[model samples]
Target: MTLTHNRKPDESKTAVLAVNVGKPQALPGQKREVMSGIVKHPVSGPVFLSFTGMTGDAQADLEHHGGPDKAVCVYDYSRYAALEELMNRKLDWGACGENLTVEGCREDEVRIGDVYELGEATVQVSQPRQPCFKLGARYDYKELPVYFQDSGHTGFYFRVLQEGEVAPSAVFRRISTDPASLTILDANRIMHQGKQDSMGMRTLLAIPTLSDSWKQTLLKRLTKLESEQQG
Candidate 1:
């Protein structure tokens, strides 16, 4: 199934936001941050952002070095409908990446592998974040992961397609599905019921990117079960 949001373009009806760097040791700025890229959530809205300072060496270091996993980014959804709770908090405890500080969004509606168009940049959704220790360390909230999962607010990665400036009030459009509708929720169901051959289940495990622990187990069980049934 596919879903689309077609809205009339009006200042009062549309919202576009980008993640801007926060003030030194403070919350992020409340203006249009020049857009470099965006972070996606499986069941939530997108976080928009812009990068600052760092140059060639520093950029490489950031992506390939130790700080890559812990670097949190930010986006502003103050214009998007449904999200308005994430504004001005010292420590937003949900997705663990040191990426963006954000507010105003129901971040869970977007799923892993979905495609989004922001300004001129297009991004492919990757996966829901599995939180780590840095998040708790930054905010002293051990239950941050629990809350994020419970709230279904997660973000995925997007490969930069067309780089351009993105800011608050920018409207996002979903162009495609995640190739098989394989959600973590669906994986859990397949594991519990051992229903590997079901239509949706088959489609999910079909994706090579999704063939992890659960899919492996499911395939093994499926093979064994198939053999027994034939016998």
Candidate 2:
């Protein structure tokens, strides 16, 4: 499919509000230390981004997180208000392990293959972040991940297309959008909400820009469902 580019109005433009980076650290009550990177602070200057991830950022479990496909995690700052209401507390900027806290781009509006120009770096929306137990561990709220997933506010990840420096308040412009129009919200519903629309699953599987890990996961589910029907 041909990529479509549309320049949005200045009033509607999205920008980075904060750039956060973290290193591995040991947490209390956990047998193994987790590099959750959830306790990020805003950077005063530009930070380098790469295929693996931003400089100084590390993942505790590489098997399920951090790779060329899942390079940078982005969360919309707007969602925090709703989350705070849901959890009945104030949350910090990087409370969700996001590398970039952005404004204007929400999960439902951002497509799976949407490409954005973030400062000197170029990144593509890879897939909806799959919340895990670590989120609950970090926040001490065992149902936080479940609440995040149910809310459809599970922030998405970015695959670095062109490595460069990124900073806070940098303009984030969408350069292209995938024609399929399968958004991160839709994908999240299929994975978490148990929405079994076979045709939708096929469409998601056909998206070349989607993360292979997600594709494999959907394929396995689809295959199992088909097998059960045949039996």
Candidate 3:
């Protein structure tokens, strides 16, 4: 399926792949720390993979909850002109909520179900956005949810199909497609109250944490809907 957008694809985009390490003397699983690096796609796994506007503020809250050095966003790896503009600022940090600061590649080009190849790993786009409580405290802008809703860049999450170490300068590419009909954005929209009736059962089955009771209840409803769709 072709993903249509008003803008052309920018293949030179860059981003970061930051992991969480507790402390200076700790391993990866010990604690959470944000590191810097370059990446091709923003929504792949082993990275924070958060959206643009609210992510900076949300990172602060995550740090407060767990560690002070929480990794936020990976940088925007698509626009060179925008990247240069941001770099010209005298600020010591490269915006907040970004563990992996990226430049060059076309992030917006990615639709739901798109697979990004990050060296030894393959990341599959999962849900659209996970708006959590951490957001409210980060910006103190109680309406962050609305901000995400309005702005379309609600970043995508990725499931790790293959595990491997990623670095700042690592290269990434695209891989295969499963149920090419689904998209991360569309799935997320469906997950919301809008197009729930149109989502595929296979996609719904992938969400493991979606409570058994809720799943069963939804299953019953979906069973009826499936009959209707088939009819």
Candidate 4:
């Protein structure tokens, strides 16, 4: 079967519903008290957006979390209800530890490398957020890490190209569209599903705007697959 992608343009001029920030705090884990920034609170005023991330935000695990490429984690505002229903628990904005909680910017609509003018700052889609055990730890649901990975409801990240003060109600403008059109949904599917399709993997690898972590991970997998195929 041939792979075909159906993408929808995010035409709605939906302004960001909330801007959230969190500093590292003690969180309850299954076996230990973990330091994490996953539990964020929505901000009512403008927050400075820099290359590092929102001014007040900080991640406990720097190696795995914060960096220039994965500066701002963004989550879909519409996903909360479905997740609450599935998890049988209520969740709020910044539940995912994302800096920007937005509407209409679903994984299928936002493409890698796509540049957008968000408030006074300019940002670009770097990669899909790869949820890990930290997420499950945050909510006290151990399976959430796996569910987030498989469900593709995992949000994406943004690299701030230009720094400025961003407000809660700022709108997103697609200032530059990536010609690759590689949606974050597709990227998640390819990575999590581990499909044996070289073409699909290559498509993601071709994207210069892809986060370095993702590129390295995908490349390593592809290399292993190639080695096995040759042997």
- Shift in Å, residue 11, candidate 1: 16
Whole-model Cα lDDT of every candidate shown, in order: 0.39, 0.82, 0.40, 0.84
Error of 3 at 231 (Å): 19
How good is model 4 by TM-score? Answer: 0.92
**Which candidate should be chosen as best, given TM-score against the real structure?**
4
- Report the lDDT tens digits of candidate 4 across residue range 147-168: 8788888999999999999998
Best by lDDT: 4
Per residue, candidate 2 scores C-alpha lDDT tens digits across 1-231 of: 222112222326587877887776655566676556555666788889988998878877789988999999998887776666666676666767899887778888899999999989999999999888888877677898888888889999999999999888676889999666788888888787764667778888888899999999999989988888899
Using Cα atoms with residue i matched to residue i, what is each candidate's TM-score against the true structure?
0.45, 0.90, 0.48, 0.92
Model 1 misplaced stretches (Cα beyond 4 Å) = 1-108, 169-171, 178-180, 183-203, 208-231
lDDT (tens digit, per residue) of candidate 1 on 1-231: 222223322433223333333222221232332212121222133334322311111122233222322232323232222222232232222123323223332233444455566554554443344444334433445565555455444443344444444444445666776644665444443545445455555665675544244356667777776778789
Superior candidate under lDDT, 1 versus 3: 3
Candidate 2 vs. true structure, TM-score: 0.90
**144: Cα error in model 2, Å:** 0.5
**How does candidate 3 score on lDDT?**
0.40
**Which one wins by TM-score: 3 or 4?**
4
Candidate 3 lowest-lDDT run of ten = 21-30
Consecutive 10-residue window with the lowest summed lDDT within model 1: 50-59
Cα lDDT tens digits, model 3, 157-184, are 4555565655445566556545544544
